[model samples]
Target: MTGERGSEQGSPVRNGAGPGQEGRQPPVIAIVGPTGSGKSDLAVRMALELDGEIINADSMQFYRGMDIGTAKITAEERKGVPHHLLDTLDVTDEASVSDFQRESRAAIADIHRRGRRAILAGGSGLYIRAALDVLEFPGTEPAIRQRLEHDLEVSGLAPLRTRLELVDPVSAARLGDARRVVRALEVHELTGRPFSSFMPVREYFQPAVQIGLEVDRELLRERLAARVHRMVSSGLLDEVRRLDSLGLRRGRTASRALGYAQFLRVLDGEADEEQAAEETIVATRQFARRQLTWFRADPRIHWLDWQDPDLVAKALTLCG
Candidate 1:
């Protein structure tokens, strides 16, 4: 139980505010949405209005040199609000959900201690859940993990996927990557339980409100495509090159990021910038669709139209 914020560890409010002050504490506010859906801007606006700080839940934004492709908020865009957890990891480091859970919970507790709202913002579904939900992470056994990874490298994903399907059909249906397939098999072998058994239920770890940004599917596709093009025009390739030189390619998670992955091909002379941009656009749109599906499944989220003129006010109402 690596990600478990156990009862013995105490609640976020317990360390920050006493029982008498609990009634006065503001609920943790989370702004969640797909890429290019204005989550960061809305988070900033809400922070300004609510006297709050932002804790980034975007896994990509954790990397120090991954700004352009991840659309990390500019210093000016943060508007002097103290943002937590951005640029905390090197591009060569793999982002871990359990580690994020511990760090983000600590940040949230600190924000509450200062009596300011903690606004969790980003599009990463699992990272967001790890921050706000009663989630538990299974401990990793390196030997088993390495063996499964070696199997994946030698036998490929199909054989491993089939093995997972036999033991855990739910996770087999849900997971779509070789890395995750390996992780699922590793978990099962270590614990003798299906990996899906560890999935977080829709239970909040603390008083929290989730505001989801809803956008028209076609409009979001157009926005994502245009955003990728803008990233290209705004030196995304140069940023990728800089990070690549810093061993970005060696990082398991950072190297596979949307624009970074496609752009790496361009650097290798396999594809030109235009082809990379188009491919990135396609991949980004597909990612957005998956994000929408994940966020939509949570009944607790209050959905707001991304273009609503009174969006901030509506979100504030939900927070209250």
Candidate 2:
């Protein structure tokens, strides 16, 4: 599963204040919010205050050369604090939640080893949940995935959905969509277990704090629109063009990023700048809505109005 920490194979547990010492470890502070909600700013400030290092949880920000559209924090914006997992992968590479979890755990452990706090920040709820809850997924077979891919190409997702519904009704109910059903079925065919059954039970790092940023919907919409305009002005189209030249046009997960997908359409002559920007804003707004839904369902999050005067103080109190 993406973001779940498991026991290290062949590694011995240390006594007292050492690695894997959950009982004696310092808590990780996770700052999460929707895209365009200033989570990077908040995380940087929190890191400065708490002597923390940041581990990125956003899925899209990991790719190289995606700076403007993903709104990756500049080195100056990082304010001399160490940030991990940004711009670490090429666009041709595939990144997954499991990859994030493994890397993030190592980074967090290193931060703790250096006697600094670990700050997890970004807008990807799945990545954040994987880190916090330590959920794990079952392994899949390549042949099963290949067969499912063929089915998707020939009969579409209906056959896959029916197969998954028979094998993993709980996962089928939870997924409820064609693409997800196909994926679940692929995993079931590979592992012989319900996809959802592989999920780890909820777990938490004690003494940790979670801060969520919220804004008025209209305000967020305006911000998203303005951000899209700025990105276009900043050569986002050129960036997409370069990525497309690398044979990452569509269907790939990296190509599906809000700005990249819209601009790819522009390059295909299917849309103009204005249309691309409009579509990007609409997609981004929907993504933000989904993020809010995911975070709001978690009872542990300490909600903060984006304009709160004493937000940092409140977060520090929770961390203590």
Candidate 3:
């Protein structure tokens, strides 16, 4: 498809076969990459140039008051571009992929209503995949959820993992970790079907284009280190302390976030500032590596080198 170059405020001009000939819908663009890879900045630029609104796909950025640690874009950074799904919930609230999918769909629909493109942007592969694929999980029974919570509190995750392995070995095999195992077992007990059975392989959206940012490993590592240091300098410890006061204790999902976890260790007197920052950097690097692994496995994404000066043009071409 080819189109006229339009201004940022106007709709993109289209010059190709219209939607529906091949069961395709209007194209939506997504910018995905490892954390600290400038995905948001690129998304903002694309939005300004392509008449798009950014829908955040990052999991952590959903929580309110998690700006510094999450590397959340500030108002000034957005440059008047409208962004959706960031800082929309309290840290105490549990936001899941289902919630993200629902909210993102609404945001995309709104963008389409405005005659603009929707730009999905973040490092969270699971959230992006959940939004793009028609993957649904079985409903959970309240009573079963309560029971599972009680069991988890009483016996911890090992028994839950064992139970899940017995009920749904496929899901259990895929979710052998303590956190995932508990969730899988909870879903199994709540709904009749295995968790794995709910995973749909069909496309959820139509005519979507995925663009991944690529950076040199050494440069990424250096940038991550600097980012962690900046977070430390920018009151990340204070932020963790506030969240801790909200009853988000250590080792829970919220507390285990990269910067927050390190600060929690420092709060427990387990580490010094230097040690905490170093450990946070290391953990973030490891997390980025995992993101790369996940993104690499997805064949649909087109990778663009972040170092390229004309990345926006390359991304726009890819979107076309």
Tell me, by lDDT, which candidate is best. 1
TM per candidate: 0.89, 0.90, 0.86
Candidates in descending lDDT order = 1, 2, 3
Residues 1-320 of candidate 1: C-alpha lDDT, one tens digit per residue:
12222111212221223455546657789999888899999999999998999999998898888989998999999999999999887777777777787789889989998989899999999888888787777767778878888888888999999999999999999999887888888778877989898887788777789999999889888888898999999999999999999999988778999999999999999999999999999999999989999999999998999999999999988988
Across residues 93-185, which tens digit of lDDT does each residue of candidate 2 receive? 666766666677788888888999999999988778657664665554557667778888899777777777789988867776665676677
Of candidate 2, the 10-residue stretch with the lowest lDDT total is 6-15
Model 3 gets an lDDT of 0.77
By the TM-score metric, which is better: model 2 or model 3? 2
TM-score, predicted candidate 2 vs. hidden true structure: 0.90
The regions of model 2 sitting more than 4 angstroms off are 1-20, 205-207
lDDT of predicted model 1:
0.86
Local accuracy of candidate 3 as per-residue lDDT tens digits, 102-174: 6687787678778898999988887787667756545544566667778888998878877888899898778
What lDDT does the true structure give each of the candidates?
0.86, 0.78, 0.77
Best by TM-score: 2
Off by over 4 Å in 3: 1-25, 149-162, 200-202, 250-252
* Model 1: lDDT of residue 285: 91
Candidate no. 3 TM-score:
0.86
